[model samples]
Target: MVIVLDFGGQYNQLIARRVRECNVYCEVLPYTTSLDRIREIAPKGIIFTGGPASVYAPDAPSIDPGIFSLGIPVLGICYGCQLMTYLLGGTVSKAPVREYGRTEITVSDSSNLFKEVTTNTICWMSHTDYIEKPAAGFTVVASSDSCPIAAIENTERNLYGVQFHPEVVHTPEGTKMLHNFLYRVCNCNGDWVMSSFAEEAVANLKAKIGDKKVLCALSGGVDSSVAAVMISKAVGKQLTCIFVDHGLLRKNEGDEVEEIFTKQFDVNFVRVNAQQRFYDKLAGVCEPEQKRKIIGEEFIRVFEEEAKKIGTVDFLVQGTIYPDVIESGLGKSAVIKSHHNVGGLPDYVDFKEIIEPLRNLFKDEVRKVGLELGIPEKLVFRQPFPGPGLAIRIIGDVTPEKIAILQDADYIYREEIAKAGLDRSIGQYFAVLTNLRSVGVMGDERTYDYTIALRAVTTTDFMTAEFAELPWELLGRISNRIVNEVKHVNRICYDITGKPPATIEWE
Candidate 1:
């Protein structure tokens, strides 16, 4: 097992995900974790995640210097690298030229971390402070244009640090570097797999929820489906899955979800058609965060109502994955968006406790667990959908009219992608109902209507993503069909911006 210490970096979870990709089990704990706790876990390796802080700052996050003396291999990235240098009597100061985004670095072939990696390769760098000097006995192994000491290592002590991130995909060979650290340095056997995780999770759930009634928030999405099945496997009839059909889902999604769960699953399934309840609460709520919070709270209220009917439910389950938790401001990471299942929950929930079975797993990892649980591939690979549904997809207030329009347009967009045989390739694709309305000439008639924005991204971890470069011919077809078939949408535009500039969801 490997452990990642979070230093308030946005990519803390991403680092954990990368480690897990090496077929090693990893967990992220706060930097404030005590040395005793570290010794308890006895992790095979320790990783310090990069953060948005200067090591010299008065309030900068720090760790126990004793961590290095523990003899466990440690690898630090970016701020983590600077933190290691600073705590060990090395100089860490503001860089003459702050490096951000992709940068080329030269590495010595002797370092274990860069074992099979190219000597001169690109890496993802995002740091304002640079390690100016290495601590005593530490040798500089890598250098970049602006940063002289880009990578440092004390081979005898099993300590390594890099100014650039090897977790993000922008680094290209970053995975290979991580693989070297895990196998060559840490001596991990790569024995961890999804089947083992599923077995352990089921055993743990059964032990914790024995004879206790559990309620599951089943959205019929891959995450929720996997969570519900795992719970049912643990506690058969004791589990009840409550799916709230808030009017925000894609076209025909509500009915589709109901049909699948009721027919296929063995556990008790309840479908609450709370469309009007959600729409009423969301009336005039134009703010994205507000819409998410209202939907999240309403979902709880609906579940609470159902729980009362079924006596008492000791635990509530959500299908929230790693991306949802991190994007909702985990640790020091900025809140890019408030996912309905994560940050949008109410202050008080009626249930005794909330459980997220797939909390630490990534999107792809969840799919793997789903397959291990024997879930249908078609259901496991369903297009990723947010809990707030189409409300966030619509840029402004969500009315039944706007929902209908957006749903039809989004359905057409998805259908076209599937018809083009790009469904399995694209990670996520959907349509957004932008608030902008433009004047257009349709069949020689002057008309002013809403604009439809289409979004498609390809990603493995869902932490970082790139815009899918769709064929222009296919775009023309989707646009033509939406403009002609979906009413009230005259203008159709494809989102060309990537994740940094724009999220997959417009809101």
Candidate 2:
């Protein structure tokens, strides 16, 4: 496994993700991590993540120089690279012209790290400083116009550094460089599999919760259900899943979650119909973030209430995956969004011990593990939804009137997408209801009601995404179904914009 040392770089998690893509597990640690702790892990390889810091900064982060002499293979990225040079007796100062985005670099001297990588390569560069001179015994292997010392290496010490990021797609062959480091430099065997991870996670969970009961905050989504299943396998009836049916869920979703968990899986499951309770707290909320905050708080209140009824429980399991944690701003990263499981933990909650089985895994990894554990494909592949549920989908204030209209329209859109066999193709597709109302003629009656918008996108990572190029006929079918079946919705529109200018959700 590889260890990624974070130095406040935004793309730090991406580095860990790329290593995992090479079938090697990697954990992100803060740059301030004590050297003794790192030695305990004794990782197969160490990766230094890029950051928004200058080596010349008076108070910039630094690690012990002895780390280079520890004999562990090291790969340093942009900020990480500069930090390496400054700490290892090399000169690093601000560049006259900062290199950012895509830039071309030429391989000056050959090294095992660049094996099979092109002599001339387009790399994603994002740094303000450049290395004036590399450390002692380190040779310049790659160079570019703006950043002459683009790549530096010391093969004898098993250390390498690159000025550009290879984790992003802009650097097409970046993953290859990491593979070379993992296999050649580090002599690592790629043996990390989700099945093995599941087995180990279950064992750990059981040992942690022996004889004590565990309750999961089940949201009926893949992440939560997978966590619930794994815990059930480990502690059987010792785990009780509480599915909170807040008023904001999609059409018939409450009933579906109950049936699937209670009748089919049959592990101690409890369904709470707290729709009115949630709605009461969420009344008059109009702002998007405010609504999310209120819903998240209400959810915890429900969970705390459930735990009190269930008696003694050691842990409260949440369905928090990697995206949720990264989005909520963890480990030298900015907060893109606050997930209920991440930031919504109010001061008052029943269980202090939180167990997140899928915290390290991505969305795709969770789905794979779910299928590997024999979970039905339908449940595993269900469209990703937020813990706040439909509250976020409603553009304005959420009410029974808005919820009913959006639910029917959303149902129609999903049904059409599935019928077209585009359910699995589109990354995340959903319907949004606005306070907007448009004029339309229905059987010679002039109707001015709600306007519904459809959104669909394809994404490798939720970080960057592109709008799905859905056919016009498919859109027409969805539009027609919504207009005909769902009253109070007269106009339908499709979101053609992608993640750059617009996020997937309207709010």
Q: Which candidate leads in TM-score?
A: 2
For residues 14-100, could you state the per-residue lDDT of candidate 2 as single tens digits?
Answer: 888889889999888877777788889999989998888788888787788888888899999998888888899999988888778
Worst 10 residues of 1 by lDDT: 341-350
State the lDDT of candidate 1 residue by residue for 1-507, as single tens digits: 999888888778778888898899998887888999999999999999998889999999999999999989999988888999999999988877778998899998899998878999999989888887888889999998777898999999999999999998799989898898999989999998999999999999999998988988777678888999999888888898888788788888778777766776679988888999999999999999999878877787887677678875799888888777767864555678876663344445556888888998888899999899888787888898877889999988889999999999999999999899999999889999999999999999999999998889998766567999999999999999999999999999988888776677887
User: Which segments of model 1 are wrong by more than 4 Å?
Assistant: 279-294, 324-350, 395-402, 434-451, 458-467, 483-491, 497-503
Overall lDDT per candidate, in order of appearance: 0.87, 0.85
Candidate 1 lDDT for residue 385? 84
RMSD value for candidate 1 = 3.1
Clashes of each: 0, 0
